[model samples]
Target chain A: MDLSPIWLTLKLAAITTSLLFIVGLPIAWWLSKGRSFFKTIVEAIITMPLVLPPSVLGFYLLLAFSPQHGLGKLLQDTFDTQFVFSFKGLVLASFIYSMPFMTGPIKSALQQLPVSLTQASYALGKTQWQTFKSVLVPNIKPSLLTAIVLTFAHTLGEFGVVLMIGGNIPGVTRVASIAVYDSVERMDYAAANTYSLILFSITFVMVISVFVFNKYQAKSPLE
Target chain B: MIDLSIEKRLKAYRGQQILKISHQFTTGSITKIYGPSGAGKTTLLKTIAGLVYPEKGKIVVDSQTWLDTDNNINLPPQKRMPGFVFQDYALFPNMSVLAHLQYATNDMEWIKRLLLLGKLDTLTDHKPIHLSGGQQQRLAVLRALAIKPKLILMDEPFSALDPDMKTELIAELKLLFKELAATVLIVSHNPQELEGLTDGDLYIP
Candidate 1:
């Protein structure tokens, strides 16, 4: 059985999880502050992926970045990048598909923190950025780890979105999930079973690690 | 001298109650703020520390305009640094006792002094989660003073301490506050808790 698909899947999951972490942190922090009409709308849009069908998101993403018209045309004309059937397209799709997993836990943990933690930091002459980096982020380590692992595992399991946007290109767009589907269609049961078993084990380990870490984190009086 | 006049709308158990106060604090003086429950005692401390925004107010601290709502000049909490010992301690669970003071200031000697004052020198490596209630309270007070702030706002700093420990700590803090020339505003339900330490008193009715 070919192993390129497994490597590609790992690469995609790593990149997607890292990018989402950098981008999702500030968004989650902003959303946790309080509720406004604008924040509600933004959160709704971000959370839509969890409820919306993957096929629908994939279809829209393909059309929007088809390199034929609209945003796709704009990108094609300026940066000369195609995001429809490339590895880049898969990353973009994974971003939209797995975003809620990354932000949900983080946002809730941030909201759960006592307001006095922030006030105490500010009272010590620390700026808002300092307070967030030193006080807020450190306190939410367990939740952050959970978010990262869940996002990684979710990206690894993505099939419908990848199938729609990233077609079966041997070394480029064909991830482990897509490879498993391809093997079944060609009557390659052995290869399909191998891919399925690998994904199952990896995801199992990641999820179990999250539960263990959370349980081990010491409980605080303030929490 | 700190001159403060502020009005804020508070959500009380009964309904809406307006917290109105106009007072001046002499430099290096310790003032005890006593009031009944839901009298906005904590709110008043937060407002002075710039943690809470008053609807209409002016806070002039030692000739510095900390807040002037009419003039639209309000310094952020970072700009108006004040040592605040929260009622709940608000200690960082992830940081050790030493780390808390180090975060507030780079003065190693000051940190050592504060550790001794709070009698937490041996537990410098312990996190808040590992400390007892009284130990956590002392850490909170020590962390606040780590910055050696000109203004100190404490909300029941000795609530968890035993009577003997409370008395001893208060006496040490009184001398330290005088040495640092820090103005202190303490809120407590029990007036006798701070009996002789405070030179002035502000009663909110």
Candidate 2:
């Protein structure tokens, strides 16, 4: 049983989760502010991934990044980057696939905070960025942790998008989910079962930890 | 001295009501504001602090134009830099009694003085959640004072404190306000709370 697929899957999940955390915070913060038609449209687009089938997202990403097409052609000409059927494509696909998981909790947490918290910080002469970092972000720690974990777990379980854009290539795009499917197709029951169990156990542990942590937080006097 | 004239449209239950005010506050004066509910007392404070922008207003603080809708100049809250104590206390649940002051300024001596003034020096490490309502309210007041600001706006700041505690704290705060030469605007539902402390009075109908 080759372990390359498992390592690749872990790497993809780590990279995708890290990038999503950095990108999602600002997006969530902006969205959590006063609502508008433009913000509603952007939020709808970001949230579409949660309800839309992963294969639909994968299909669109493939069309958008195919080297023979407009955007893909421009990228190929300018940056010499090929997204389709590559690790980069897998990472990109996972971003769209797992974005809602990264932004949902954070946005809601931010919205639930008292308006006076920000106002108090501002009245104290703290800049917006300073208040966000020192006050807003610190207060949203639990939700932030939940967002990171859910994004990582969701990325690890990604199968449809990876299949559509990132063709199963050993040591590159052949992540655990793809490997499990390949094993099953080859009638390799033992390998399929092993990979399935590993993925299932890891995700279960992560989800359980989130529940436990949140429960502990609920019981604490300080929020 | 601060000269402020502002008008804001508020969404009252009975159609819309406009809040209009034109007032001057002398430097180092403490003014008590009293009004019925929905009269926009808090909104007035927020507008002055730059938390809320009035539809038409001019706020000139010590010759500095903080807001002038006619001139289209509006300084943000950070630039205005007034100290404010919110009605809800608005203490950071994650920060200790000391961290709140530390976030405002790095003056160790000032911080120590504020801690002692609020009588929260012994509870420096305690978060807002652990403090009693009075303690939390005092901490909010202390956090506002930590900046040693030229202006302080408070909304129902002593509502949570017992009468005796309120009196003692007010007495101490009066001397401190004089020492710092800070002007203050306090919105109170109870007029008696700030009877002797305020030199001026503003009543909103």
Score each candidate by Cα lDDT: 0.94, 0.92
Candidate 2 C-alpha lDDT tens digits along B133-182: 99999999999999998999999999999999999999999999999899
Estimated TM-score for each candidate: 0.97, 0.96
Query: Which pairs clash in model 2?
Result: none
Candidate 1 CAPRI classification by DockQ: high
Chain A only, candidate 1, TM-score: 0.96
Q: lDDT tens digits, residues A140-165, model 2?
A: 88898899998999899999889999
Candidate 1 second chain TM? 0.99
Model 1 lDDT per residue over B133-173, tens place: 99999999999999988999999999999999999999999
